[model samples]
Target: MSSVLLFFQGLEHSPLSVGLRASEWMYPLVNTLHILGIALLVGPILILDWRVLHRRATPPVAALATVLLPVARGGFGLAVVAGSLLFITRPLDYAFNTLFQIKLVCIGLALLNIALLHWSKAWGLAIKDNQFSQSVRLACGLSLVFWLLVLALGRLVGYR
Candidate 1:
């Protein structure tokens, strides 16, 4: 246990980690950016998901994705960067937190789902005809579920 603790002690005591811990203002600022990233990433995603689920009737999926995926990617950039900074402040907490682990797994599942969707024929159908197969609908449903779980687990990390 001491050896495991020692491993994180090195990370927690890093210069940047120490600085982040010491800065009263920066921590909250970075957290705010993380939330902003989540918003940017999830907002468009929800909109797209709504369309997939027949909850909306506006832009086609491919057109909407063309506009939104890049935005989500940009938000993902902000999230990973700020999240890394925040995680560095207390690596042990994140490393051990069950919810934190769950959140990471959910994020990975969501990414994998999207990758699989892109590789399927539904992607071409969506781009060409704005319609997709049942598999894509299932993927979209899973995407929504996984992302929502990630959000919940992310918030839960703070409780522990």
Candidate 2:
């Protein structure tokens, strides 16, 4: 783990990373964009997740999935790009932060959970049966928990 952290510390000192560090405005601007990307990604996602949770009145799960999936993908894309820019600026600190690692793990799990939900091949059956399955609800519940934790850990990176 020490060696791995050293590697990230090395990355933080790279020419590009140094340039970002050297520029006062660049880092903050990029971070702001990264946060904006998160908003783009998480906001619509909660709505779809709400459908599964029975929190809000919306179209059926299958129909809502069709609409919100694209928006979530766009948000994920933006967050990835902006996050990359923000990450290199302080790789070492993030590499060692316990919460940061947890955040990363949660992100991986969140993505995996969504992929599994999509690949489950149950949506069509549930739709045809005119019922919502508990599996879908479970995935949405997990996604909600994981993403909320991710948000908290991300904020903790600054304080911890």
Please tell me which predicted candidate would have the highest TM-score against the true structure.
1
Candidate 1 residue lDDT tens string, 1-160: 5998898889999998999999999999999999999998988888887788783446777788899989998988899999989999999889888889889999999999989988987877876777766787898899999999989888889877
Models, CA RMSD each: 1.7, 2.2
Give the CA lDDT, 0 to 100, for residue 102 in model 2. Answer: 90
With candidate 1 superimposed using the best TM-score fit, by how many Å does residue 102's alpha carbon deviate from the native?
A: 0.8
> What's the CA RMSD of model 2 in angstroms?
2.2
Worst 10 residues of 2 by lDDT: 123-132
lDDT of 1: 0.87
Score each candidate by Cα lDDT.
0.87, 0.81
